[model samples]
Target: MKKFPLLALAFCLATPAFAQSTQTTADLANTVKYRHAYQSMTKLPDWVAKATAVSVPAETLKLDGKSYLVGHLCKPHDCGDHQLDIVFSEDGKAVWGLLSRRYGKTLYQMPLGEPNTETLAALTASYHKNNPDDLAK
Candidate 1:
């Protein structure tokens, strides 16, 4: 009887931990898939819209154990001869700005602005310079 109670207690304790681990694994996998999908899209407008649509998976938990999703969007330029890059992230509940730029050996970051025709034009210009074939749209 004592052994039975002890076994029950152990099982109870292990169950939540196992569930949490499984949840984390699933969340990480989803994050990776979103990252890849964001990378594969060639158009800026589509990329922004897609990034904005990302939501935190149900399995994610904040540091406080509260569940939340964060989304981030960024545009970056390399200072001098370096390359420029734009990045975005979404966790489900909210989006974040993860912009960065390099300026003469220094790095700068700013939030992504709302997508608009003008912004798309600028992105097209930059993309054309970086990847001519991307203009196939």
Candidate 2:
């Protein structure tokens, strides 16, 4: 019976490592699964695919008492003018994005409509956090 308690403690310690194994931008970028998922949610731009080739991992963002993972992608040479910040649910089941163009002045939410407060908050926060300079513009 004492061994059972030790086993439970071990499992608890290992759980976080497993959770951290969630895929990052670099891991999911080239996969058809991610592309299809995003496309199913909204129109996937041609530049988006190209941007993924230069993808980078991003810090997670917390909003409305929920946590989300942010992914950064940008046009290779023209990054200053075109960029994308994708926000994925912790489980990666849901996805949304903020596309920034013309030096981050123009913004568009994916799915072609105004987003609810939480979503707009998450996407905007993720984008600005990843591109701090854009916040000043």
Best by lDDT: 2
**Cα deviation in Å at residue 85, candidate 2?**
0.7
- Assess candidate 2 and give its TM-score to the true structure: 0.52
Model 2 C-alpha lDDT per residue in residues 51-127, reported as the tens digit of each score = 55467777777777789887777777777677777777888677777777773466644432345677777667766
TM-score of each: 0.23, 0.52
**lDDT for residue 104 in candidate 2, whole number 0-100:** 42
> For residues 1-137, what per-residue lDDT tens digits would candidate 1 score against the true structure?
78999999999999977774445644654586565664565334433445443222222224334443332232223122222233122344333333334465454533454534533344334434444543464
The global Cα lDDT (0 to 1) of model 2 is: 0.70
